[model samples]
Target: MNPHTISDDKIQAAVALLQAGETVAFPTETVYGLGADASNPLAVQKIFEIKGRPIYHPLIVHIAAASQLSVWAQSIPDDAWRLAAAFWPGPLTLILQRSSQVPNEVTGGQDTVGLRVPDHPVATSLLRAFGGGIAAPSANRFGQVSPTTAQHVHDKLGVMVGMILDGGPCHIGVESTIVSLVHGDAVLLRPGRLSVEAIEDTLNKKILLTQPISTKVRASGMLNSHYAPATPIEIQPADELWIRAHQLANLGYKVAVLNLSDHKKCASSAAITRFQMPLQADDYGRELYASLHRIDHANFDRILAEALPATPEWVAINDRVRRAAQGTTNETRILVRTENR
Candidate 1:
């Protein structure tokens, strides 16, 4: 079946489904979200069941606007307001103290809740119509490639979801930058399109970044090996990436290259596929998920991604790359061996 387009009627139908304690997939600036009513325990349970996500990993609550933040959070810190003013309706998620009104299932039995006001029109409209926060995560199976388009959701959930609100491709293809505010200070839990420097500038206070490895994490996508494709992925320097790609190709393994530059490189074997990401940081972040989604389905034996720049600007993108390539059990090690010519 063709993917359904976004319309008021479709939005109303999705809202009705949520109100009736059902699951739906809706578009957001970051990616499509598999959402359920945050206040309803049963509806929230469906989200976890559908994605096969662990109940220990909490979900983010999407609201219509900043005005609704207090409805879900017990107390909104001053920094949260500043961050919301600077990044809300965009791709930043603020984790705050959860109010009693919020269901435990939505917060994964934690005292804190992650909240965001998506920039996508369809998401805002649906949230407004529902008149409450909606718990949503990337519309894909747990630990799999995230959905950047309506077809991605349909391909994953099929008719299991009551509705799909298509809003074209996502503007920011990766998940939001999640900041936990439970400690009265803004802590950067996850990085995304918004950089750490950007968040610091808004709050005029130094932000503490969580280590890559954390044992006390409460949200999904925080683990080392997540958002991975079926094929194993390896990261290497640009100078060595092509040689490694060709080496893997010659080894009788289907290999694909994800380049972060404009110019395309020559491949010795036709079996090696090359894909270039946008030269700009923002565009690259927006296309990261879609690119991975494609490579995951290309029947490649493994994916060899070129290491991105170590500059501060590329921090978020690199974080996602490392996580995506890391898989569920392996580290994203940099291969430094020379090609045997």
Candidate 2:
């Protein structure tokens, strides 16, 4: 089966499963989403049980088109419409006040709901056939690396999903940019495949970089530790990555390096492994999760990554990487440096 093509029968099968209140994992431009009927509280609860996701963290409701927006969300702001018109059918998610039609299960008991029209043939086909909202998050266990391919979904979710729609590898390979319009201002709740500049360009106004404290809304991917791999991860400066990786390897610990520099410059040693990363931000985003998924299963003692630049273009990548590396400490670095001295 082609990654870009999904048979109508397959799509209809997924739609049927969703309509029956069974979870269906389908491809989106960003990542595969574990989808459930948004109107069914019991069905939505399955998503939480399947992913082990906390009930407090809301799921983004995937719709077939922008016209269905009012069906799930109310008090739709003008900026939400503008952003939807500009970035919908793509990787931008708009957060708006929940409509009475929306169940609290989908919104995590919050008054606001996050919604997006994903730009993938399989996802769009299933949504159109179902003709309703499907609340979905990354089709992986909570706090783990998100799945980017059907195989990743199957491996991570396995028999838990009623069906898997193999649309191919995710094109964008990251979550959508979540912008909250519930607060009357375009607040960026999460950085994702879509850039902040693009949203501002469409709205012709600067979006708030940080969500205000008083009006804070709980949205997906807002946690400090998320998208993490099982192996502990540490990030080091490009200037120091080699040294630190070498130190850990010399310390008799197996280490893997997510080298962001030129591959040839970072030589792998007997105890050290290196995976070269893409230089451009877009390419990097597409490979980040898949690479982490690969690295996570390779049985390394620790994963060390070269730090990315803190530029506007790399904001989304940095955000994901930083969150993924949360709870990682510098104890290894300290041990290595102290031993070398």
Candidate 3:
């Protein structure tokens, strides 16, 4: 199937923007990425300056096809190709030794680079039109919620980015599954919409981790306090969320909720913003960032978010929530569901 389904004019415009050392926020199968020309070291530096991202944290180089992977990476192992063959042009990212063609700024002074071929049509079209790797990361600020829609990017960044390709919402709400093969073992660095079990099944080997491999290079989204909003996020159990939010509201707090549970409530108070989320994991993931972006600007005292079930399907959602709730010290009291306890 042809992935260049985006209009030729839009692709050409984005290509022009990128080649001029300006950044463009383009859609991918996973999330919207702030894209810059990977070959230009100064262009890559713009990504860091605009997002306030640390130079030590590298960006993922997105390419149009698997054939172009050799241009940016060197010493590619057969296992990496095997995994890429199975999951490439999709959400799986393979880390390999960086080539001289890829500028040092894109790799954050590391010898390895993160490479992926996004399955999204507009993204592939942009990459093919540009004819080179685009160093892209989530379009949000250094560690805030990611942008799933072009509007989210514009709302957060304003005119900071040269342009944003409106490719609709991202299919997968989170980032890609990062598998590092540079240090002699297939190490699973990050678990995303693609489950670790599925990648292990495809590679047909038990993958190791960063601790066991002892790699020092930092991949994207590895920070402990990331994806957080300007407001604090408190992760509360589903059952107690209503009571806790009510209590806080009674104390003059503006409570905004993102709930996926069937437990329903009709709040009369305007201070509490209740949003019903999708029941399924993928549907929920697809709208996660957009929802957070909307609620974060509502000026709530704190977002009392209800927690999701801990399961393999919810790994990406949980990871984002964990990072979102980092540094928030509000612990809700677990009250027993009894008439008189």
Candidate 4:
């Protein structure tokens, strides 16, 4: 299919396909989603098949409004309602006990499901017209760079997809912050644009924070190697990264450098591609994924990113960078040179 801008006709067509138990790619503020009728087992199955995503891991259901939450989950906690009011139509997902009406296929046979009302107008329109929750994960093959634009979806899943809603570039450029309330305690399963402090402020109580378990995972994109690029990624201290980058370059490795700022000096012989993120935390968070998307496309032998300050505001971005550097070998420690420090 030709890549075109999103239009009312395209939205209508995509909605129709979803109603017929087929999958379509649509945009949200965070990332493009491969959407299917959450209530339709066959349609949900198609999503897992297309993305090669395992069924044991659940998918997040996108809704048009907070009013639609009860239709998908068994009960909404008071905190969940408060969060919806504060962050709905934004990038926050709530995981709650599923109602019997929610198919096992959508929730990976679990008793809970993740639901969110996206801030994007096109996604909201599609959800409202379809009259049911839509199960949508990022519109990319499983364990690949997520699509932030309509073209990214087309480039990855075109022809394999029934339709693509060209909603332009995603603004948030990351997945939603997933909060699981299924176990009677508010636990943050994944962090996105919504910081833990923001969620705590709305709930009026401290929230439990937990990292994704590598074994027996129940949610999507929880794996360590997820959102990885074809090239290797290394995470190290700011000062010493350039010397290692130069060493890799001398060894015939093409490298890209992502650091906090461009103030650092490196050897002249280094064949390094450098990108400087904003010094401010929120600005850096918003631009994080787009930068990775660009670096992933560059023909680099590896991506070496400098570690950010260990502070509360940088938590979410740190989680993503750490996960991006995770490899099959389960190695998190890259070489750290004392001189660079």
Candidate 5:
């Protein structure tokens, strides 16, 4: 095992590295988070620098306990407590008014901050041992596929991450479901494995899913064109996807196909490769980014994907796929469009 991967066993060392204001990539219930001391603005700044993230983008502060929320954020309402009580140690983040201790840099110069308590034990142990909040975003380059494994972090960032705490793969491979309580109304900022219905059921109220996202309340994953890969990707229905892949292959372009094919469909020829995504949404979500990371490293010149089902369970997956496929222009378009269905 790598030294970085052993952070789960040597948690004290991981805590020590964080206390020294160095960045570490650690696993959470969602994707692996690139963490630094939240209170240390300089350390937090390094996270943005290393990831090539924009200064205006806010970072989520991960805590070990729900009680610690008050330290970073202020004016927590009853709805926040109710949601936290129900979803803490899970894949949900709450945006609230920031405390003076939370620097403007953390909130992208806004008066609010995103806070989460990850459900991974290694992340909890690190927070508890360090005795403070860890400011983290996804542990990959800005606007790229988020990393789910420690190896993904190391492969993408190399030594940019001082250490990586490998807690194996994340259970939920997408980012956390972010909701804003800063306005005293339930507004869904971003979707994740935790569905909107689950959050609404926990709060017993109907929540708004999308909004104009004013400067005062900008949250994570608000950007329209993010989470993309270097490969030019086009998405279509499975039948249409295969037709596109075959056409691209005939044009002398190597292509990769991703669909919900339980059995392998295309043989791996010089110009064509194939992969199967599970039909179930949860299983598909878990494999989404990691699979993308693999496809990204391959020699494929173009990628053709099958669009997921347009159902409530697939909302988060749909949002991510749309964003990831947003900026592929040169390779030709088939059914790639981000406009709402």
Candidate 6:
């Protein structure tokens, strides 16, 4: 299949499945999404069951155009319109007050819904053809690495999805930047390729960080232990990367080192494999998940990733890496090394 073209016939078939209360895995600029008719409660439930995602966690509804925002959300704020005009048909998501027309299932029973118009031809084509909102989340298992390619979706979801629309590799290679307008002030719920600075400059006002303790709205990707790979990842500081890799390798564990810095000093052993990652933030974000998918399948016992920079430009990358390493611990890493040995 040519990744560049999505035939009209394919769009119609996907639309049929969705209208009949079924799910389809389709690509977006950020990632492949497991989408279902946003208006169909039963079909939305299937997404939760298939991905083992908690029902209380919300999903983002994809619309064909910015004009359709009113269909899913009500009491839309002026800031919503401003941001949409700037970032719609791209990688930004706006959370607004839900409309009566929106199914409770789509919003996780909350009064707010997450909406975005993906900047991808296949997603837009499918959305325009479907004629309504499509509630979607990253097309992978809950708390696992997101699928960036059609084959990744098939490998993770298989026949569970009624149809898989392959739109090639996601260009952004991360989820959408999610900002909430339902509150009195704009709050960033999740970070993606779209930087927070960009959003603030567009709104001309400071966006608040998410206050999990006080915030009632539950947005997707809010959990600490998300986007994890099957192989537990340990984020090592740049200075200690080689030391940690050698430590694990000496203990007889197969360690995959995700290196984004110091490319000239390539290190490898029978138990250690090194992968050179993109140096720039944009390129790194685009390649992050695809690299995770490859390393996850390569029979590695653990992943030791070099810590990324702490600057604003690297915020999204840092967030994802932090979450991916959230569940990993020193004890667990040592245990895996010893067990493998």
Cα RMSD (angstroms) for every candidate in the order listed:
3.8, 3.6, 4.1, 3.7, 2.5, 4.1
lDDT of 2 by residue, 101-172 (tens): 888888888999999999998888899899999999999999888899999999888999999888888988
Q: Which ten residues in a row have the lowest lDDT in candidate 4?
A: 332-341
**Colliding pairs, model 5:** none
Candidate 5 regions exceeding 4 Å error are 1-9, 212-216, 261-268, 334-340
Model 3 residue 184 lDDT score: 78
Better of 4 and 6 by TM-score: 6
Clashes of each: 0, 0, 0, 1, 0, 0
Off by over 4 Å in 1: 1-5, 211-217, 262-265, 328-341
TM-score per model over all chains:
0.92, 0.95, 0.91, 0.90, 0.93, 0.95
Off by over 4 Å in 4: 1-5, 211-217, 267-270, 328-341
Q: Candidate 5: global Cα-lDDT? A: 0.85
lDDT of 5 by residue, 14-55 (tens): 788888989988899889999999999899999999999999
- What tens-digit string does per-residue lDDT give for candidate 6 at 49-75? 999999989999999999998988999
Residue pairs with backbone overlap in model 1:
none
lDDT assessment of candidate 1: 0.82
**Ten residues in sequence with the least summed lDDT for candidate 2:** 332-341
Worst lDDT window (10 residues) for model 1? Answer: 332-341
- How would you order the candidates by TM-score, starting with the best? 6, 2, 5, 1, 3, 4
Give model 4's TM-score versus the native structure. 0.90
What is the C-alpha local distance difference test score of each model? 0.82, 0.87, 0.83, 0.80, 0.85, 0.89
**Candidate 4's residue-wise lDDT over 181-280, tens digit each?**
8666788888788889999988888888773343122676778778776667888787677877787888898888777756545533457877777887
In angstroms, give how far residue 110 of model 3 lies from its true place. 0.8
